[model samples]
Target: MADQSSEEAARLHKFVDPVSYLSAFVSNGVRPDGRSCSTARNVTLNIGSISTANGSAMVKLGQTCVLAAVKMELSNPPLECPSRGYLVCNIDQSSSSLSEALSGPPTSEAQSLSQTLQDLLSRFVDCDDLILVESKLCWTVYVDVVCLCNSGNVWDACVLASTVALINTQVPAVNTDVELPLVSISSRRSLKLGTVPLAATFTIFKDKYCLLDPSREEELICDGTVSVIYFEDGGIAQITHAGKPLSSERLISMCKDGQTHTQTLYKLLNTVCT
Candidate 1:
């Protein structure tokens, strides 16, 4: 029985190696998925997908899938930001994605991805817009993202989910009774948001190829990555580069491409949600 187990393990190792090498080779200039480095895999988003949450969205980027839910509750505004409400983001990676050999809490990879999404979202939100009252009470919005599947490019998937969830969210207006000095809570309404933000990530390989929205296999062979978040009006919200410094020319090209991509995504979201 032990011998049989050993043989199976060896076969598994053998199967994984050639696939890894082939993925690396493809990263140089070709993708097994046959997508150009600058092209994104097909994206599909479903808004109000979760019935329990106030607002929810499911985003699928290729095989990667993520669900984001937005919940709002009434709370006193913080002293520092008295006029603005608070936004909290939490991300969790499901254990099912990990191999049997890797058992533990979220790995560094997961934590970094979570932080990236948090920061990217922060850049687009105008916190002051969420304030309903001066210092007494305000809406606290909580966004939670769960990785339902790992098809690679979790950052992009999470960002897509977050964006759609925010758009779908409706903050209930506070209701007050006539006799209580407007102290009682009653009903709810949707918050007015000015503009939405979108993010696009590119993976650099062989110091030449810049693949947009890399899958799991392409990510392994890539030299580094860059994620750019853009707001409407052609303004950049955030830019993150990891691994090495990219040339200014490449950065410019990415910004140009990101603008076009952001516009495309924005239209898609509006069409689906409406």
Candidate 2:
């Protein structure tokens, strides 16, 4: 049985070579999906889908689907970082969707992706904005992301979902001093956020062609990927790259493209929210 499995794996590896070649050809200004190198797949954002969450959103980027839920709870600050309110992001890939060959807890890939998002969000959200009191209890927002489908570009999809969820979330006001505390929510209140940050991912193939928002097949063949996080105020919050390093010229071009794409995504989110 082991021998047969090994043979099958070898055959699969050999079969992938031709597909990689075809992907390389498409990366150079053409694609099997009939999209240009800089084009993004269709994006859809649905808000308030989860009843249990204070704020929730479902985002679809092409075939990739992510559901993010935000829950607000009163809690003391972390021992290490007590000055600011807590913001926790947990990302989990659905085992049902992932291949059996990739079994485990979140691999390094998922870990890095989560951290990148955390960094980008930290830059845009002022933790002080969530503070209802000084040293007492404050609202700690918890964001949970579940990737239902992995068609590619999961990072970008997750970012979009988080941003929309945050915008739609409403925190309940608490009267801590009263004997009969009132936990009433003012729906008209909006969270004080600084700016919205968007993320765009680009894949490099054949060390020459740059593909944006790659599909799962393309991701399997690519040499490297770069995910750039752009803030609305024309600032870059984070840049995460995996695999071989890309040239500075390519990096600059990708950043420029990401900036333009980010604006479009922001507008789309605004339209959906309104």
Candidate 3:
């Protein structure tokens, strides 16, 4: 009876004031999900999981799961820049992943996320590598990401899955002798890619405590969130903030943490992706 009463009181506190409720846990040096303030959730990576796609990968960051697939299509290069090709990105959120059922087009948030991801990926991809025949036909690389779960930190998960999928992707051999290009489905070669880029997200509570890799519930109660994109070499690609402003010192500290997190992810990729 005593334990039940305690649980009831906890629920009441959470409903009345979420920030204070979360603060109670943080003051105790632990989060509701049993993780330290600085500790991130476990990450799982898999490559070439989808046989039908040219290349595919799946990433799991705790309960949040994302799948990414790459498809190659042939198209004419733009007249202005005939030497370059294209790298397109799209993101889809599954109905089961959200609180409500999705019946129509993607939500505005999903579209915004897709556009942001595309812009970030464009910085890494070299369209020159996509050219099959210069000034003629080129490969349009389509990268599709599907959110199977939205437990939290989805941006990082999407980036991880997309990067691995691109690494696993292969281009089919093309026969240019004929009027129409003949693609050999069985004959394929992998694209050239350099260092992979990844993202790390942090949630700030009450403008004081910074939590790494926040869960869905934590995100709801967060005062602000920061996302940092970086490469394996500790070079930052981008930093974005939402909700509240942060001090320069705090931003720099988060960047350092993001760099460290990227290095850890790179090592894990090497071990699991082969």
Candidates' lDDT values, in order? 0.77, 0.81, 0.89
Using lDDT as the measure, name the better of candidate 1 and candidate 3: 3
Give a tens-digit lDDT track for model 1, residues 1-274: 9999987875675467745554454557566677755678888889999877878999988988899999877778899989998878877777764442145677777777777666666655667877766887777788899888777788878888987898788765554333322422245455556567778888877677777888876677678989887776778877989888888999999888877777888888889878
Better of 1 and 2 by TM-score: 2
> TM-score per candidate, in order?
0.81, 0.86, 0.94
Which regions of candidate 3 are displaced past 4 Å? none
Q: How big is the positional error of residue 273 in model 3, measured in Å on the Cα after superposition? A: 2.2
CA RMSD of all predictions: 5.4, 5.6, 1.7
Ranking by TM-score: 3, 2, 1
Report the number of the highest-TM-score candidate.
3
lDDT rank order: 3, 2, 1
Locate the minimum summed-lDDT window of 10 residues in model 1: 176-185
Judged by lDDT, which candidate is best?
A: 3
lDDT digits (tens) for residues 218-266 of candidate 2: 7887789998888876689878888897779889999988888888888
Q: Could you tell me which residue pairs clash in candidate 2? A: none
lDDT of 3: 0.89
